[model samples]
Target: MMQYRVEFVTLCALMVLAAGAWGFVALVQFAHAAEPHGFDQRILLLFRDPANLSQTIGPAWVHEAVRDFTSLGSVTVLITVILIAMLFMLFSRRPGGALFLLVAVVGGQLLNSWLKVLIDRPRPELVPHAAEVFTLSFPSGHAMLAAVTYLTVGALCARVVHGRMLKAYVMSVAVVLTVLIGISRLYLGVHWPSDVLAGWCAGSAWAVLCWLLARAVLSRRRAGEGLAESA
Candidate 1:
C-alpha cells in the first residue's frame, strides 16, 4: 500500500510537470512576439515613472533592498553555492546525485545564455535601470538561474532527506528564493515583467526535468545493485 501510494503521488507529480512544460513552451512563443507588442511597454511603465523616466516606482530604500536580493541570483553567488553543495554530495558517497546537480545547474546556465542570445531582446529601455546589466534581457538570467539552482538542489535534497517537514521547508525556501529573485529583476528595471515570467516558466521546467533524470538514474542504480546482490 505504501509503495502504491508513492507511485500514485509520483504519477500526479509527473502530470503536473507535463502541464507546466507545455505552458512554458507556449509562454516562450508568446514572449517571442511581444517585442513589438504594446502590452510589454505598458507593463514596464508600471514599475517606473513615464514622465521622468529616470525614476523608479518605489521608495529609495526598496531599491537598495532589491539590489541585495537580486545579488542572490548572481552567477558568483549561485556558482559558489553549487560547488559547495556538489562537493558535499560527492564526499557523502552520492556521486551520481552530485553529477546530476552539477549538470542541471550548469546546463541551465548555458541554456539561459543561449536563449538570451537567440531571442536577442534588449534590456528594458522604458525606464532607466536601477541596476547595472551587461547581457541581453529576455528571460531574466537572474530569475532563471535562481529558480534552476534553488529548486534543483532543494527538490533533490528533499527526495533523499528523511522528514516530510524538512522536505517542505527545503522546497519552501527554494520557492521563496525563486520568487524574490524574479521580483527583484522587475523592481530594479533590469528586465521586463514578461521576461521574468517566461524565465520562471522555463527555469522551473528545466529543474523538473533535471529532478526526474536524477531520480531515474538513482533508482536504476539501486535496482541493479539489488539484483546483483540477489544473484
Candidate 2:
C-alpha cells in the first residue's frame, strides 16, 4: 500500500510539473510575439466580420447576460463555492485535498490578476465595444476563473466517480464549459484569442499542479502513518 501510494504521487507530480513548465514557456513565447489584444482581434482576423453582436443583441440582452456572467465576479460566489468544497473535504477528513483545491482555485485567481497588471495590455479598439470595462485585458479574468472553478470541481468529482469513464465524462464537461466561457468572450468581442489561450494554459497549470501537490502530500502523510503503526 505504501509503495503504491508513493508511485501514484510520483506519477501525478511529474505530470503536473511538466504541464506547468510547458505553460510558463508558452506564455513567455506568446508574450514575445505580440501584446495580447485578446480573442476579439483573432476573431476579426479569422471571420473578417466587424459586426458587434453585443449591439445587435440589444443593450438589454447585452447588459443582462454580460452583467450576469460577470457577476460570477462576486467574490462572495467564489468564496462560497470554495468554502463548500473545503467543508466537504474537511468532513471527509481530507485536509490535504482541501488545501490543494483552495490553493489551486484561489491562487490561480491571484496569478491571473497579477499577470494582467504586469502585462497591462489594452483591450482591442479595432471595433466598437458594446460595454465599457476598465480592467486590464491581456489574460481574460473570466476565462481563468471559469477554468479553475470547473477544473477543480471536476478533479474533486473524479474522486467520487466510480469508473474511468465517469472520471473522463466529468473532466470533459469541465473542459467544455471552460472553453465555452473563453469562446463567449470572443463571440461577445470582449477578449482576444491569445488572452483566452494564456488563461487556459495558466489555469490548467494551476489545476494540475495542485493535484500533484495534494497527491504528494497525502502519500507522504499516509506513508508516515503506516510507518508509525508498524513501529
Candidate 3:
C-alpha cells in the first residue's frame, strides 16, 4: 500500500516537471520576432558551400541521399508505431501507458495540423523543392510527431523496464533520434527552423499532458484494485 503511494507520487512529480519544461518552450516560440531568419537560405548555403560538403561529395549525390532518407518518412513513422504496439503486446502487464502514447501521438498530430491551417505560413521558396508538399508551415509535422512518438514511447519503456541502466540507454536513444529527425527537416529544406521549434514545444507539451492523465488513471486503478482485494 505504502509502495503504491510512493510510485503514484513519483509519477505525478515527473508529469509536473515535463509539463512545466514544455510550457516554457512554447512561450519562447511564441515570442519569436516576425522578421525572417532566412533559415532555409542559410541551410542551402551550407549544402552548396564548397567548404561545407557538396564540393567533396558532389551536389547530385547529396540531393539523392537527402531525398531517399526524407522519402522514408511515412515508413519510419509506421515502423515506430508498430514496434511500440508489439512491445506493449508482449508485456501485457500495463496497457494504460501504451494507450497514453496512442492518445498523445494521434492528438499531437491533429493539433499540429490544425495549427498549420490556422497560421498558414508558407514554406521556403529559395530553391526548387525536392518534393511536392501542400501543407502550411507553422509547426512542422515531422518535428511534432518525432517528439510525441519517440518520447512517449521512451517514457512507457522506462516504466515497464526494471533496470536503471537499460532505461537510461533506451530513453537517451529516443531523445537523440527525435532531435535528429527535427534537424533533418531543416536540412532538407522542407520546413522552417521556427516551424520545427514550435513543433517541439507543442508536441512536448502534449506528451507531458498525456503522461499526467495516464498517471492519474493508473493511480485510480491501483486504488480500486486494493479495495477489491481487501473486500
Measured on C-alpha atoms, candidate 1 has an lDDT of 0.82
Model 2 scores what on Cα lDDT?
Answer: 0.70
Report the Cα lDDT for residue 17, model 3: 55
Candidate 3 ranges with C-alpha deviation above 4 Å? 1-35, 38-76, 83-87, 90-93
TM-score of each model, in listed order: 0.89, 0.76, 0.74
Q: How many residue pairs clash in each candidate?
A: 0, 8, 0
Model 2, span 95-193: residue lDDT tens: 766887777887888888898898877776555554456787767777777778778978897887798799999989888877766765654566667
Worst 10 residues of 3 by lDDT: 48-57
lDDT of each: 0.82, 0.70, 0.67
Better of 1 and 2 by TM-score: 1
* Residue-level error in angstroms, candidate 3, position 30: 7.1
lDDT of 1 at 220: 94
lDDT: worst 10-residue window of model 2: 47-56
> Which is the leading candidate under lDDT?
1
* lDDT sort, best first: 1, 2, 3
